[model samples]
Target: MGAEHYPPPWFSVAPMMEWTDNHYRTLARLISKKAWLYSEMLAAETIVYQTGNLDRFLAYGPEQHPIVLQIGGNNLENLAKATQLATPYGYDEINFNCGCPSPRVAGHGCFGVRLMLDPKFVAEAMCVIAANTNVPVSVKCRIGLDDHDSYNELCDFIYKVSSQSPTRHFIIHSRKALLNGISPADNRRIPPLKYEYYYALLRDFPDLQFTINGGINSIDEVNAARLEGAHGVMLGRAAYSNPWQILGLVDSAVYGAPLRSITRRQVLEQYQVYGDSVVRMYGLKPHIRDVMKPLLGLFHAEPRNVVWKRKVDAALLRCTTIKSILEETLGEIPDRVLDAPLTEVPSGSTDTFIKAKSLLPPPYTVSEEELL
Candidate 1:
């Protein structure tokens, strides 16, 4: 199928490393059907070397439709091979990771955000990946890196890659990565978000699609960005930390779909079935703890949440199945909290949105010297 046939990614969960795994994605799909989900960034070398164990890394439930597989690496041969190896798994789109600021990725691996410094190579890599797969290819990148952070430099990277490859979609994280010794967690928070750079891309590259991803937490903020002419909004930590609050309203609020009638209890019941089946099939390979990790935050901020979590932690030590864990903790949370449907969507701070809008920089204009 061609890229045009797929739905435009108006709302998506960002491809977080440890958070967006298959277990979490299955849980996410149960909440919102319209929001796109992305797999974790799997290095091409990992894909190539672990071909025998491909299913462990590449396998996802069929319910995760409109899913995108994100791969990271700088090698052309391994990238093409990795794309070919992943083709049979049937991802909707393939995204190249050029934005991760991890020291292990950008330092020893010499890839990730480092690829932004070499747009020509990134273009070639995209072409190679496209050649190896039938699905559309996209790039996820930071606005800039280190001292090279400049609006024109970002535009140059975008222009060179899009002009040379078949890629039309770009997920911009809206922050410049600092390659100097800071931790990846710090990289997410320390650098100021330059949403103006993202909005400027929308103005300058009218033909390409840009998804703004950084500091966007609530569904209200996601809609706010859409209102501001953003092609898409991708949420990271918020979606993982508070799936109920963030994803529960995505279908009705973001996609104009019917409000999902399912409650938190229903979601847990469905997930329980999946957990049991996986435990039976995979055995301890996906230990019950790993399967239950995603559920830890499901009851975020509700009454007795802390007590429920303590029960869950206690269950994890003794229970060998997800059912056992839930059986012990489910009673801690009230039936009203568990069974009630989401009706009231939280209202975001309008003052915060207004302040962000006021900081918007002017749209960028291409220089005549670069036009040649």
Candidate 2:
């Protein structure tokens, strides 16, 4: 396929280990239709060993399309088998992770940041995956690891992998991985982001599409990278921690898709229904907290948001059903918000935003007592 036909994603949510699960991706889709979503990194071993429950691992709704399945493992045969198994899931892309710095990932799994030491191994893995599946194959990597941490070494790694396989997309987290004695959270914070490395990647490989990741939290930063020639941006904690607030601006700011007029409360109601179906279908014991975990940041910056969060946290202790949880937490939003000014995304925004605002339904009240 031609370059134009394979348009790189404008914005994407990163494949965080425990956080970006299918449920979280589903919640994110409710926020932005344009942003590419990713699954939590699945080990090739898990896919190869667990033959009977692929649905628990690979199942996703069509609305989560343009999603990528990120796999982590070094065994070539198992990775190939995992790629073949993932083929029917309809993923738009398959990503190999070579950037994780967690002890469990690098030390125990020996596939994540450990692979950064052997670009040839990664190249071979990519070739196997590409040969097994028709979906686009890609890699996410750090600039370098320990002794191999050099600008030339980074270039060499990318050159080797891209030259050896059909892979054209490389998402670079602009930080070197410290494989020893650092916790994953600290690793994310301590590494000095060398985005200039990414700029050089864009300049050196005109034929490849590169998305920059790490320490990017704002729209201005995203646009700045785009202006400097990045093909896309991948957000992890910033997107997952406050998904609705971050993705709420993406339609107007990034993709220029028509802004959605849907409110957070409306999203909660929809999520409730979706959660009910998921639990019933999967035989998950009906727990409101499990269903509501992904919606933790929906009311992020609103007034009394702390009170709302506290209410939810407290409710989780006793609330047995989703209906009671929604009534106690989401039902707390004041009806007067219908008349109150929107807290942000004010009148100076684009016409699509303004036009979309006109589509919001007149807000109605929900009483906890009445809802029950």
Best by TM-score: 1
Q: Where does model 1 exceed 4 Å of error?
A: 1-6, 280-283, 346-372
Per-model C-alpha lDDT, please? 0.89, 0.78
Question: What tens-digit string does per-residue lDDT give for candidate 2 at 166-241?
Answer: 8899999988988778898888988777776777777678899899899887665666667556699999999987
Output the number of the lDDT-best candidate: 1
Q: How far is candidate 1 from the true structure (C-alpha RMSD, Å)?
A: 1.9
Per-candidate TM-scores read: 0.95, 0.87
Taking the tens digit of each residue's C-alpha lDDT, what string does model 1 give over 254-317? 8888887899999999999999888635534787887898888888999999999888898888
**Candidate 2 regions off by >4 Å?**
1-7, 280-288, 336-372
Task: Give model 2's TM-score versus the native structure.
Answer: 0.87
Clashing pairs in 1: none
